[model samples]
Target: MKIIKNILFLVVLLSTLQGFSQEILTKKEALEIALENNFGVKIAKNNLEVAKNNKSIYNTGFLPTASISSGANYSNNNQTIDRQDGTSTSIDGAITQSYNASLNVNYTIFDGLGRKYNYQQLKETYNLTELEAKETIENTYLQLFTNYFQIAKLTKNKENLNEALSISKKRLLRAKYQYEYGQSTKLELLNAEVDVNNDSITLINANQLLSNAKRGLNLVLGIEKEVNYTVETNVDFTNILNFDELHQKMITNNTTLKQNEKNIAISEFNIKVNKSNYLPSLGLSTSYGWNKSQNPATSFLAASSSNGLNAGLSLSWSLFDGGSTKTNIANSKIALENQQILLEQQKITIDNTLKNTWENYQSQLFIINAQNKNVITTQNNFDRSKERFKLGQITSIEFRQAQINLINSKTALNNAKFDAKLTELQLLQLSGDILNVEF
Candidate 1:
């Protein structure tokens, strides 16, 4: 019977190993796929490109504008004129023709330096968009790693369930032989049968969980079709995290905080832009024009033509205009103040989050250590209990307890290890180092 049990265990192990014939999807591959295919990352990149395109001299009103225009008109008229000397002259169907053409150029030479400030504002806006894009990519990294590790966890769970089911079947088979030989009661055999049935159901549920987990990973990868693959079960823990260093990095490198800093700069530029409205503006305009007219009914001139170049300078001061400029400047100042306040608030929020995440990571690491020891102990207990049960030295219930302990310990250890990995990832994310994680 013992020889048969050993053979059964080896067969089950070999079958389970064979079931994992799919390709291995590594962490690096998952991240690379997400970089190329994730919807959020692509959208964020497009937005950054838009911001970059907007950072141009034309958009900031820093360039001159030129226009060319031409027109012609022809008309026929019946006319009658009475002179002062009591003489009258009448004409019919007199032809008239006129033509005009012009080229104009206008430039704002100075507007209290508003153009400079506007250009600076555009630059700051582009920077802010860059930070936003970085934030989105980092967030996608977190989500991808989270989903990838979840699949790994569920896969390990299915393996554990398979082993448990195998053990239950072996137990049931031994129970049958003992009862047939009149060494064990029917009650023992029935109990073993019940355990086998329960284990089978648990394994079925585990398989469903694994399938769902794989689908989740596929969604994160932006794969429209579902794919089956195995993952590397080994998770390397990061143990060198320092709260002080991480907090400092969060202040300097965190995308949200950096975006807020850019916002503050943009607000400052806006205030300058509005204040410039109070000063006088200077502009330059130049044009070249040609005009010609022909009238057969004219008394003095039959045809006339003229051409000239014109130039002018304009100076306009907003002495008073219903206080619109003043009001705008005041509003801009208020907005800048609000941005400063928000920056402070964001700092506080990030500080608290970093503290909490660091503590949780430490706790998970400790739990992983404890579970490692527990798994070892439970495995040894299960091995000894199996031998005792074969020698008819322990009851079925006692043996079942040992088996349950082993299974639970393995499950717990797997959960702990993966949970710790996730917590470590959170720490990296909070520190703005998620993209730098090692495979």
Candidate 2:
């Protein structure tokens, strides 16, 4: 009795643990966790930050640059001198030291608008980086959402299987009782036991599949180990959207298309920047320094020991350079044209994708409606079959057939619902409105 009591306590404890583990996680929470913890999104965000830093460096070109220098030097000299008496004499000079320090400053007065254009280009590049990050995030979110729904659907499937297994167990027990009372043959009892074992095997397989699905969800959510969580099975798809409206939204809001547009703008700016290279560049530079001679005899002591300042404006024009600059300008123009062609292609692709997904969504909705009706019909038939069997008007085989039909119908209905919901999600994603949809 004590051993039995312990077994009962263990079963209760396990049941309690499982109940606690089945806490439902909403879609919003899952997405938030993925965004916060996903490694790929973190890497993309870091890349964008690097691009922003690069832009800042380029922007510093507008600020004046200054520098300071200090140095020490020593020198010695040997020479021959002619005296007044017409005799040559040799003289050795001692070492001398000097120290000097200076500061220099340069400010750009003009550079043929090169700096402005380059800054603009860098700004555009920064924006492109941000767009790339957004694209990465959106793609990651889509994957997460798909996996979340799949796990939810699988969990529901397992529940159905478990319910069917319980029903099989009860039928097995009834068959055994009938056999004991001589109301049924041994064959019927054996068949019922076989069905129960088969159901148990199916349940085991379903449990394994559920575990795998949970692991996949955990991977997407950036969790290290397995976690027990439930997904909300209710996804409302009552809002019907027009294909034309979806296409329009995709054209306006698609990140990839917008990124390509930015690329075209960048290419145009590149051409301008390359063309600016042909014009003259003008700049102002100034420097102040103290100069000292290690040999006092060779230095002009009056000015050498003093500081001097100089400032001047200079202009440079590149007349020719092996046609490289011109070639680059032409290349930029070609790239811009290519981007234009790509933009058109992308628009067509998006339009086609939206149409395909919208049609698929409609088809799945129809399947779901049909499956729902079939479920009702199958359930009614199963009820009537059970009644007929109990009244001895039908065979046990017929009753089992009805049960199988009902199970199949239920399974099909569940699958159809899942497919319909997935299709809806795809449509919303294609329309660039998945993030805006309320759960």
Candidate 3:
């Protein structure tokens, strides 16, 4: 019975593997998986949550603090006592007990409006984090899409390899038949066998490449288990032949650019926060307390009780700090200027990037169009060469060349399509619209 159970488990495992090995993945499905499971996305989202929590007003010391405390103590000690009649007595132990309790409240009445500025700084910082998370998502999706399309190309190349191998096999068979009929030399048969072997090896290598590509794609999707899957051979592009619209969108919506703007605002607020140190600060504080004392030696005469409320207003100012505040303000001004420069530099960089990717998209489109006809012609040429080789009208070398041409054309077209997909996604990314990826 144990052996039967083991056999049943083996059968089930095999069935699962067979089914999983035939799974197909789509671009949108892969994107959804990466968005949910990718580590970087998860970390960015956590950072955004932290920033949001930091921007809270109550948490940032905006409100007053109130506390209540109670304490008690008892003491015993030896003491000497003297009376006015010139008689003295030594007490072995004298005991005393006391209790006190207080309720206190403190509030910052004024601090050059520093708390208000701090609150604005935190709000801007939170906005910066939000944009940073968006940038991470956009960049990660580009990488994922690139890997996915790579797998698509590898799949097509594998298909091309298989077709070439099949052709070699048929040609080898034909060569043998011709030699047996005294129509081909022994050298021709030998060459035919060599070509067939070479094609098989090439096909094997192509399969390995395809497997690696699939593994890369799975890693991008955050998948840990090894399973085989096929990707669709479709990458589409729309050529706008214009960068003006993309440029405008990028200026308004680009994540990094917007993040830089937030940084500038934070720096301006920092200047205010630093300058606040020059002004005097005012504080309001109040306390209510109760105290009681009892003496065991003479409880009737030494017992006492006091309860009251006290309040006060305090003010302070920093007269000097070895030029530290001045230095900080100057540094803040410099930092603000630097941030504004970076913001402008980023605009220039993004403009250059957009133009380059636009040109690349157009170039890939041209290559795809050119290769489309080339592949059709090569396929026709290969079919004819196959017939000619079988009929002894062409040599195996000539037929191999035709097969290579067909494979090259097909591979080139696939690569061009994949390149176009990359540029299209890049353009969309620069335009701040990558999350809307389709097809």
**Leading candidate by lDDT:** 1
lDDT of 3 by residue, 1-439 (tens): 3563576467558856865777788877888899998888999999999999999877667799999989998988887777789987766668888999999999999998888899999999999999999999998899898888888888878778767776676677777778889988999889888987998898788878878887877777777745477777776665543688888889998888999999999999999999999999999999999999887663445788799999999999989979998999999999999999999999999989998888888888899999999999999998898789767798778988998999899989888888888889899999898876565
Q: What's the candidate order when arranged by decreasing lDDT?
A: 1, 3, 2
Over the stretch 239-355, how does candidate 1's per-residue lDDT look in tens digits? 655889899989888888898999999999998998888889999999999999998764567999999999999999988888988899889889989999999999999899889
For each candidate, what TM-score against the reference? 0.93, 0.90, 0.91
Per-residue lDDT over 40-72 for candidate 2, one digit per residue giving the tens place of the 0 to 100 score: 888988999988987895464888899998999
* Candidate 1: residue 354 Cα off by (Å): 1.3
| TM-score quality measure for candidate 1 | 0.93
lDDT for residue 290 in candidate 2, whole number 0-100: 88
Worst 10 residues of 2 by lDDT: 295-304
What are the per-model C-alpha RMSD values against the true structure? 2.9, 3.2, 5.9
Scored against the true structure, residue 239 in model 3 reaches a CA lDDT of: 52
